[model samples]
Target: MHNSSQPRTDAPSAASEPVIEVRGLAKEYRVFDKPEGLMASVTGLFNRKSRVVEALRGVDLRVEKGEFVAMLGPNGAGKTTFLKLLSGIITPTRGSATVLGSVPWERTDDFRRRFALVMGQRNQLWWDLPAAESFRLHKEIYRIDTPRFERTRDELVDLLDVRKLLLRPVRDLSLGERMKLELVAALLHEPEVLFLDEPTIGLDVVAQHALHRFLAHVQAERQMTVILTTHYMKDVAALCKRLVVVTQGSILYDGSLEQIVDRFTSHKIVTLDLDAPPDRAAIDRLGFPCEIRGPQVILRIDRTRIADVLPGILRGQGVRDVSVEDVPLEEIVAEMFRSGSTAGTDGATGAPR
Candidate 1:
């Protein structure tokens, strides 16, 4: 849990500027026809057919010097491809993208020094070495001065609560500990921008929250720019104020999480537990769109009409306990994919009675 009252003092230096700017960026791959039979293979070497698959189509994005943004999408949504393009591991087939005002695909030493990319499924650290040794290797690789490297390493270990794990071998450490060490390695250079692809993928709840708090602190204190692609809704809800939702190889929505909820879903679910089983039929007769789950009854009411209807619903239904909450973000995201209408940032305009 975050100490909400604690004030964050981290801010970017005045010299720092928009670290990432992308426009009309796209990547496509060609698939060649393969001969299955030996007889067919003999002739296919001379003649073949192929088709193009677009991994990214006209993706445009911008990240300010100190902003934290979350990129949300289901699997096969081209999120990984976009990150790879930005990391300079793969070149884009079309358009332009700039990291710290330099095209990453160029693989310039200067551009490489300005950012770090961490893929959850990939490990940059040496498996047999202690995690601390990995950080030392990164310092040498990045050519950081001795004093600066030590300071940064100490700060990161303290912030991430991985001081004890750093001395352990990477293979022996727990999954969460390895992730923390991986993060330390990624940040030892203090790149201007950070790209995190599911950094908390396999972490337990406690580890997840700890990592989230540490990231929040980094963003607040260092003013480090971040672009995170994650499947966890809790990650988005806690760490990101803005989001870019992608699906089917295109950016579907780019805005605040609050706005996403407001536009896609208009109903708030209210759960009620009566002292005695209230007249279920009478409650059903009120017709406010409800579903009963054993001892609890859930009512969906328009956000606008919640106050107006709550009093009456409680009075007539003899409610004993009630709690109100927005519809799950997952359901809203699913609806967006199903509708196939990538236009509105606000939710649909239906009001529940």
Candidate 2:
């Protein structure tokens, strides 16, 4: 039901261009204090008090043309707010952001045509009408030509496997199927930048995996710049190399996934399958507590202490099998959040620790 007013189109990028450039981006909301009762309501209209809620503190970020980046954070970590700033949905109270060579808040015709926003919970399509109608609406709003629109639409429909669901009312489709259609509608114009907020929020395990695979395929095929906000670590591990961890309106860590493990953890889980219960004193000498269950002994060993201690554990003839492994990414991220790492650090560079 809407269309962006534009003059002419421009050429695509060279793949090395910086698609998103942000500096000291911040947003704050003035939340008014309200009181109960009719008298309070009347007085509030004339002289109401309010408090400033800083949803996003001074944050700096840069995303390359085709890089897939994951923005990780707790429940209220300003991840969504950051996306709004970059996508031009809202204006920043302070700082500047340049997305695709234009200020996002300007909401220019060029920017609107080149990017798409897909929120998992928010339904942009009509509830009573079929998804096909929504796709048609998007085409009209974006001013896509007939041949180009059909080609892109059919290609996305085939790639996402949503051809059968096109005729069904959006309200009737299953969550997974509906989500696929949503992505189809978002990408019909072949956008260069995609801002995805919790795209796999409530889908089942199988559906979640399918959606992730489809996203990987779409990104690879189209070379789109993607900014994904997610709590799911599996998505980060599978699809994203650059992770930006945010907490309490601040960037705690901005680096590669490997570097996060290195900077945060210094120990590995060493499990021993004991032929018989080991002497308690043997488990005690490792300097860390051992989790004992019947005959198997689970030891957490510091990387440095492993060389000194492994020989002693193996010397015990009762040892059946010993396995050493790095701590899992889930556990590492949980540990980082446990420490309440909301204080600001240098994240603008998107560099390793």
Candidate 3:
């Protein structure tokens, strides 16, 4: 039987090397023009024109063993394209990528055995059959020995909390329940690397939190390398210590989330709730830019001047309640893209503060 405590080293290793190495990875798709009218359609069929949609343009990435990294970007920002290239689902048109020292698109049996890709929107389990049965079938497909399969399956079920739901048909399970089963099935063989594409997508808050905890546990206990692509900023912020932010088919901000915030915005929103609406002139006399919205007074205080400006606003306004908060990450990122602030260092690339 496989031991839960032992590290899985079944895959081929090139002198205990990095799990993944990518350089100048790029992919492009031909954009076909739709015919304007019936005559144009008939003509276009005969003489078609196309444009290049650069899904991923020269993305340079490297992932080490046992490191959990998150890839974040808005829709159509090349995050999915990059994951597909790494998983060998789609081949990159340029550059090179190696997973466990093997070319991803090569379809080698050894390489296939060493990794698992779990896509949240895609269902891998059989709809009609019990999830346990599907897992058993996959165990055979993976050729996992009885002892090893039992040990891994049991461990995954316990960790993912899907033991009771395993015998139920996959189609009958709730979204959260199905996700739990999917996780167990994917990890049944203890793949060295796990690629999660929106693994927490479409889940409720509680379900999302559950999955997040499970992922954290799996990372800590197994020491497996994971490359996650997620649009949910909360998932990225909570799980990922390092990150790569891709936009317009390129790596735009590839550092810490905190760095992104710090570099993009210097304005802090400080809210002060007053017992009564304060005078506009009195609020402005504090010498800081302030806005009165409802019963609250907000200040657009600069990061450098927040300390000096905050106390004055409260003391001057006779504040009943006060709060200090950095601008949301989403707003900062939006501003960065809108202002065209691409290709610059923010700060720590290793992890978020």
Candidate 4:
């Protein structure tokens, strides 16, 4: 176990080398097709039909130490597949990846001791046993020193405020409580890399926020590298600065949230609160998509034309308030998922050319 009281002297010394690196990585599954009708099924038994489904394309990525990157995508987008490949849960069909200076599929004991994979939908603890028992098991499996194990477990339990729930059976705890314990279990060994797949799935807003705070605190303290796969935009916005959007077995966008919005969105949301209802003819002249709610007028205006257009709208009527904001991250991402276009994007950084 890592000694929490002292700084990690074992971290890679070269700052230029990424802790996680991938090139032309891909995965494919040969799924068999089954016939539906009884007669067809009987005939198909003699000759099976199968097709290859590409779960991940030839993707290239690099992540340095201590970076929290979030992978966002729709269903069947291969986000979980990438995480599994990196964590050594599954071998890739082609290409290569290295985590913490070792090939993940090799699954060396040294590498296994330095990383942890947590999937929200899967439970690592025994269902019938108390969480405390599971913690003891982890200590033994990891061969953690007694002092280090006790200190780490106590600190984590205190930080998450779940010391009281440790004695409860895993099956008895609520979803949120069990998640907290799961986190505690994963962290007990002080792994250098953490792979989280929808760790906040099915969690309430409060629970999500709590987990976010805990993750932020621990990452900062340990300088741990985390790669998260989650559908919750709130999780992406809250915990990760670097976002990678995947779709149709390929990366659609890879950059910061701000970069994604600026690249994909061409318009700004302008809302004006008028003292009186605006005239329809005048609103039409604005030449933008406009919606009127009571005395408030909302318009989606091109970013480049904002200077020329907004002055006219403000001067036209009794404008009590005017505000211009970028499109929400959620909307921009949804549009990317719908389009799945990589045009005008730099292959290296996913930035617009």
Candidate order by TM-score, highest to lowest? Answer: 4, 2, 3, 1
**Segments in model 2 whose C-alpha atoms lie over 4 Å from true places:** 1-16, 34-47, 276-281, 341-353
Residue 257 of candidate 1: its Cα lDDT?
A: 80
For model 2, how does the per-residue alpha-carbon lDDT over 46-115 read when each residue is reduced to its tens digit?
Answer: 9899999878877776678788888888888899998988888999998888888999999999888999
Please provide, for model 1 over 102-183, each residue's C-alpha lDDT reduced to its tens digit, 9 standing for 90 to 100. 9888999988987899888888889999988888888888999999999999999998878888878899988888888888
lDDT by residue (tens digit), candidate 3, 1-353: 00111111122233556788888788999999987999999999889988998787676666678978887767887777877888898888998889988999987888889999999999999999999899989989899999999998888888777788988899999999998888888888888999999999999999999899998888878899998988887898778776666556655455566666675577788888988888888778767777888778888778899887666666663678888888887776565444322322332121222
| lDDT, candidates in the order shown | 0.79, 0.81, 0.77, 0.85
Error of 1 at 5 (Å): 41
- Name every residue pair that clashes in candidate 3: none
Candidate 2 TM-score to native:
0.87
TM-score of each: 0.85, 0.87, 0.87, 0.91
List residue ranges in candidate 4 displaced over 4 A: 1-15, 341-353
List of clashing residue pairs for candidate 1: 10-221, 263-346, 263-347, 264-347
> Which prediction has the highest TM-score against the true structure?
4
Residue 307, candidate 3: how far off, in angstroms?
A: 2.1
lDDT of 2 at 221: 89
